[model samples]
Target: MPVLRQITTCTEPSTVVIERRVRTRDRSVDYRLEVCRRHRWLASNWTGRRSAEGSGGRCGTVMDYRPYAQIVQSHADLWLRPLAANGPEDHDGDLAAALRAGFEFLTAHREPTGVAIALEHAARITEAIAAGALPLVEGQAQVLAALSAAETLDAGARGA
Candidate 1:
């Protein structure tokens, strides 16, 4: 099983929880950590310290794009999913998972020799399966063919 580095979650009441899991028991290590709104973060948002183009904010150049992409993705997902998810009542949950699966499957299979999962890749994996074909990570050409077949059925659907 994959061990989570930390689970940073925010709830309806707007509380952000950051918990780090300890793999083994050790006197120096603590397993349970809880923080609330009273918790303090010593972050200084210095507006004057930034470069002309704001290079300081781009500290992790390559990795910085994801959080921004995720922000947009989450917003888009909320708006777009209702159409796809509200299909035949029985298939509702599956609909959401399949859409997510489609993107996960795509990142698992990319064009280059090295695999890189782009946060901005809005590939409708679940939607593809929702439309009827499975996304096989064999190659790009085959994947496109499968996607086309998926779109055809999706267009024929009465609801989503």
Candidate 2:
């Protein structure tokens, strides 16, 4: 189980909740988190920081490109299929775990690049499964492949 931490930003009275869902043998147990940002200032401030830093704000870098809330919401969106099928209440634990994992990963990485990468791969894999290109039981394989691709790209860029 991933630890859940609530981090309050210094600039605003906003609380960012980090949740993580442990992976289970059941695919339905795979969870994604939803991030809700109530304050507009946070988003604007994050954008300003990214621009000032000259970092693309996408990949692991010096600054966060997307507000923490957006990152959470986006991942939730990406992981929608499972959530919808299992119902939110049924997957709350896993959702919390996934959120924690995402928060930790983004905090350590400092880049939100994984959002696009994961989203892209998720869409592709979902489509493949629907079309029978990939077996439904191989969903974990799809996730691993996506992660591997992202890591490979990151490694290649670093090597260059």
Question: Candidate 1: where is the Cα deviation over 4 Å?
Answer: 1-138
Which residue segments of model 2 deviate by more than 4 Å?
1-114, 144-160
> Root-mean-square deviation of each candidate, in angstroms?
16.4, 15.5
Which candidate ranks first by lDDT, i.e. highest?
2
Q: After superposition, how far is residue 85 of candidate 1 from its true place, in Å?
A: 7.3
Cα lDDT over the full model 2: 0.36
Report the lDDT tens digits of candidate 2 across residue range 24-134. Answer: 463222222122344322233232111222222122111112333333343354333332232123445343335334434444546555543554565466557657877
Clashing pairs in 2: 19-96, 19-99, 19-100, 20-96, 20-97, 20-98, 20-100, 21-97, 21-98
Among these predictions, the greatest TM-score belongs to 2
Q: What overall lDDT, based on C-alpha atoms, would model 1 receive against the true structure?
A: 0.28
